[model samples]
Target: MSESSIAIPTVYGLRSSGNCYKVQLLLDLLDRPYHWVDTDSSAGATRTPEFLALNPNGKVPLLVLDDERRLAESNAILCYLAEGSSYLPADDWDRARTLQWLFFEQYSHEPYIAVARFVRRWLPEGHERQAEIPRLLERGGNALDVMEDHLGSECYFSGGAFGVADIALYAYTHCAADGGFDLSRWPRVGAWLERVRAQPRFSPMAA
Candidate 1:
């Protein structure tokens, strides 16, 4: 089909969670307009057969691109949209570093920092998941420590310039206190967060 005949892109996500916020932030940052579909996974919106067809994992932050093409995994969506932009590193090794931190953000950081924030902010009062808060706090702290060490040497997560690496990690890192992880201790990280915020067209994650 011709490009003009394609449907516009649309993104589906819950309000909370850095995973979802990453996509929203990138879309806002780039001015690559799209429709936003508010999906509440906790309310079973993600489990429906229709949503599963879009993403079998049943996770939020799924993107349906122009012409009905679908992309899942927020990082993948970021890369797809960022292909020709400054947000994507051009040098092979430098680009790899961005991917490395993006992976770390998902594997090591998101479970602790993002999950903890979800439990604290999204879960109802007196929820049993509160029992895991301490573990979440510890893991989140460790992630922040790694981030602090890295940011001490580089202005951005991947290196000198702000790229997908910064956006991928910054989504949750900025709101780490919601997960009970303190930012006061990580001065470098705090500075990095400020840098990301200062970028032209920088967008805050939806409330």
Candidate 2:
């Protein structure tokens, strides 16, 4: 399709969500212009009939093209927007390797880190979910240790350069301390976070 024939996409997301912020970060980094619809899942926005029509699974970070086609999942949207950009690896094994880390972020990293952040930072104190904090911190720290070991040997995750994997892991890992995990214990991961921030067009997560 011609460039003009393609529709600009709209993102439906909560500004504070790391998953949502992942898409926002990449779109800004690529200099791709798009619309943002601030939808908070915590406020029952995702469960609305209109949003359910767009994504039956009812999640934020949903991307809707002007043509009405929709895409879901933060990492999937990252890969789509980053196609042909330096944020995505071009080499065969490198791209697969990037996917590996992306999967690791979702399965190992985000589950622990993101959840703890949500419960600790977003929820009121004494909320029932605060009980999960201990387990979350333990697993989240394990994930960070893995990253620390890998980063001690190399600069970025996956392709020896900045890419989607970095974006994926960087989202929650950088804010892990808010979840009660001490970043000082993982110096390599700390340095990697700084490296990601130094990349051109980087933006901090919404406060």
Which prediction has the highest lDDT against the true structure? 2
Ten-residue region with minimum lDDT total, candidate 2? 1-10
Candidate 2, residues 143-197: lDDT per residue as tens digits?
Answer: 9989999987789985888988999898898888888989999999988999889
TM-score of each: 0.92, 0.96
Candidate 2 residue pairs in backbone clash: none
Strongest candidate by TM-score = 2
lDDT: worst 10-residue window of model 1: 1-10
In model 2, the runs with Cα more than 4 Å from the true position are: 1-7
Q: What are the RMSDs of all candidates, in order? A: 2.2, 1.4
Task: State the C-alpha lDDT per candidate.
Answer: 0.85, 0.89
